[model samples]
Target: MTAAEVDAYLAGLPQDQRDALEDLRKRLKSRLPDHIECLSYAMPGFRQPGPKGKMVVGYAAFARHLGLYPHSGSVIPLIDCAPFKTSKSGVLFTPAHPLPDALLDAILRLRQDEIAAGYGRRG
Candidate 1:
């Protein structure tokens, strides 16, 4: 999605939650400038664009919880190495929840690996 679209969506959220999600979005962009691609999926998703197309990594929002959608084979294993809680296919963290920095870093690294492996092409 365009920056404007992202802005509008964020604006529609409740104040505190909007602030938190916006903060998360800003931090993700700053941390993974090269690997990050922002677009609207079920919500705003940060993905690794592949030759076959984009592969989603994760998405954060005010409604429920942040969802880490690790598309590569190694991501789930990496997140499992961490102390954070997760479900079958994604890591779920609530709005009141603190962002799992270590897990996020690992996820970013895994995306980098996918890119280096040529599994990700620029989108």
Candidate 2:
């Protein structure tokens, strides 16, 4: 999604939830800079272009939690170390819960590696 689209979506969320997601978005942008691309995928997502020109990272907002989708298999280790709860392919963190910086950093690093290796593409 475009930045405006992301802003509008965030605006519609409950205040605290909106704030938390927005904060996370800002952190991702600052940390990854040109490495991350914002777009809509069922919900707003941050993507990393893969070595094979596919999407490597896909993050979105769910009803009760934020969903972090790391398309690379290497993300498994980081997901395992995540302080917040996760299921299947994503990390699920609530607005009331604090952001897991270490986990986030690890995720960013994985995305960087995927991009360097050429694993996905931005939609």
Candidate 3:
């Protein structure tokens, strides 16, 4: 889905879920004003174009929780995601208690570095 489609997707969600996800999207856009917003793995995310163009990260909201997808193999595992269910695949952030800014910053920075260094390529 394109960025517009992504917006539509969020709009279709419940009020609370839409607000939470849209907040995340706005913050991400402010941090990555130059990057392109795209649907990576069917989720809303940012990407840098070129030969090395790749999705740095993405997010999805489910019936139970919100998920951050770093698109890497090791970054998620390296972080301590206490009180939240986490694994190599992604980190779950519930609406009742969303992820902290520090953890989200760390995740984005790590994924950006991996993309810049050509370390992790999404499948």
Candidate 4:
């Protein structure tokens, strides 16, 4: 997938969701300067650097909320995502209430660690 595809995904979203996710995309870019952007499972995400890089995180816009997916079920349980709806692998938020920087950072760090530890990647 290409950055244009990711932009298309954002462009197709509702304005509120677009704005929220655009902010998220920027923040994620700033935090993950070395990570490559890509699309996975129809969502915009970043991948680790390698011939076969692993997806580190993903974000999507839903009818009711936005989501930050760490691409790992275990990562969600390891963080404190109070005030946001969360499932086994995704953290749900809204444009009105987006994921805080600290939370996003924590999620990325944990997922990066998991990738470094040889987890959540294709063998």
Candidate 5:
């Protein structure tokens, strides 16, 4: 899916959720210059380059909070996600309390390394 799909997803959310996810979308775009922006698993996400490219990250808005999905179960556990609610595959935050840049950077680095090493992908 294209960015327009992502845009539409964001547009349908409440104002707070929209702003929060939009902020994340911008951050992801800035960091992942070589990655393709698309909608995956019905979430706005970035994919690695090429036909075989994997999903690097994804974000979505929920009724109570926003979620940042690394698309890998192991990625979230490897980082310090204090002060935010987290699950095995996603980090949950609110518009008032967004994920920090450093945390996002760490998540990106770890996920990139995992992708490079083929950790979560099947051959």
Candidate 6:
């Protein structure tokens, strides 16, 4: 999604989902200036390195769940994702069942490490 799409997407969500994602967005932005609001893989995302930046993490709302994509399939294993459903690329949650704070921290830290190791470095 583009910036406008992101706004529209969020705006179109139900109140609870919107509130949950907005809070997630804040937490995503809390770490670095590079984690700016944008789109990644056509979803609501944060571009690290700021404008025209590499995608660090992104999220999207689905009919049944929400997603947190760290842009690295490998980073998924660094955290314990026992209770939630996880794919090779991301973790899935619901508004009634968002990821815990510790899991979010672990995901962010692991993503940073992966980036520093040149996982998602843009040309």
Q: Write the per-residue lDDT of candidate 5 for residues 3-117, one digit (tens) a residue.
A: 8898899999999889888888999999998899999999999999999899999998888989999999999999889989899999999999999999999999999999899
For residue 106, model 2's alpha carbon misses the true position, in angstroms, by 0.4
RMSD of 4: 1.2
TM-score (C-alpha, index-matched) for candidate 5: 0.96
Instruction: Return the lDDT, model 3, position 25.
Output: 90
List runs of model 1 lying over 4 Å from the truth.
34-37, 47-56, 71-74, 81-83, 120-123
Full-model lDDT for every candidate: 0.63, 0.68, 0.83, 0.93, 0.92, 0.82
- Give TM per candidate: 0.69, 0.75, 0.89, 0.96, 0.96, 0.86
**For candidate 3, lDDT tens digit of each residue in 2-82?**
789888889888988888889889888887888888887878988876555777788998988899888887788888878
lDDT of 1 at 95: 66
Better by lDDT, candidate 3 or 2: 3
Query: At residue 94, what lDDT does model 3 achieve?
Result: 73
Query: By summed lDDT, which 10 consecutive residues of candidate 4 come out lowest?
Result: 114-123
The alpha-carbon deviation from the true structure for residue 9 of candidate 1, after best TM-score superposition, in angstroms, is 1.8
Compute the lDDT of residue 33 as modeled in candidate 6. Answer: 55
lDDT for each residue of candidate 6 in 50-72, tens digit (9 for 90 to 100) = 45556778888888889999888
| Tens digit per residue, CA lDDT, model 1, 1-123 | 555766777788887777777777777777766544556455665654443445546565635655566555555655564445675555666667756677777777776676667764556
TM-score of 3: 0.89
TM-score of 6: 0.86
Provide the lowest-lDDT 10-residue window in model 6: 31-40
